[model samples]
Target: MTATRAPQGQEETRAGLWARLGDRLIVGGATVGDHGRDGEIVGLHHGDGTPPYDVRWSDTGRVTLVFPGPDARVQHFAPHAGPSAVRQS
Candidate 1:
């Protein structure tokens, strides 16, 4: 078996991934012939990254509200200048 990293960002524990405003969501399987979609969280309806996020798609360049499923995973980005506590396990 091979390992795969989340596209465009790093994959950390789900604890630190509350679907932050600027974080990205990577969905689908990590293998060949996999279809996945990703986008940035622009708006948070619940104020937290719980669900129903407004995402701007990289492929379509459009913003849409999303309720991510179980197949979805989050990829968090680092701040401009700060120590990141998002460690990979």
Candidate 2:
């Protein structure tokens, strides 16, 4: 069988995004609570090279808040899986 090659640079992009998000969340005064806890990652998108994802959190089916930042900021938060929503905040 022939060996399959993975996509080039995709991993790097993802890593970069993750780092950016982590840094921004730290700087923006956001904290990551329990994964299956009270809140959920409700949104994600590419921000202009600063924070990539405009993450939203919800508790009890109501949107509690939104976190928008530089593209780098959102990248780190993109790994979460849940309902999708975007709000400018």
Candidate 3:
């Protein structure tokens, strides 16, 4: 629900985001929001009640989060490239 901007000339990488999320889940035992991808920590609500969060990428290349459950469905739209693929206009 809050937004923080990255430093100038600095950008977040997907691997870094994933690592951060993994570390947070492992250490904090709570969910977190991935600002880079706009994903939320849906919490583990299945076996251990730590439901896995889903990442939904938008057409504009932005990503969002989806809570776990029957409502959470993976929808693949396009193939995402690495940071190398992001070229400034």
Arrange candidates, best lDDT first. Answer: 1, 2, 3
| Model 3 TM-score (2 dp) | 0.20
Query: Which regions of candidate 1 deviate over 4 angstroms?
Result: 1-17, 29-32, 79-89
Off by over 4 Å in 3: 1-58, 71-89
Stretches of candidate 2 exceeding 4 Å from the true structure? 1-13, 16-38, 47-58, 68-89
Candidate 3, residues 1-89: lDDT per residue as tens digits? 88887765554333212221211121121345522322323233344323354333432444344443432322211123332344589
Candidate 3 local Cα displacement, residue 19, angstroms: 14
Highest lDDT: give the candidate number.
1
TM-score of each: 0.62, 0.24, 0.20
Candidate with maximal TM-score: 1
Predictions in order: lDDT: 0.71, 0.35, 0.32
Error of 1 at 33 (Å): 0.7
Q: How do the candidates rank by TM-score, highest first?
A: 1, 2, 3
Clashes of 3: 8
Q: Write the per-residue lDDT of candidate 1 for residues 1-89, one digit (tens) a residue.
A: 89866664454455533766777877775677878788777788886457888888877989998878788886766643111354567
Q: 26-73 in candidate 2: lDDT tens per residue?
A: 223345552332333333354433333333333345543344443213
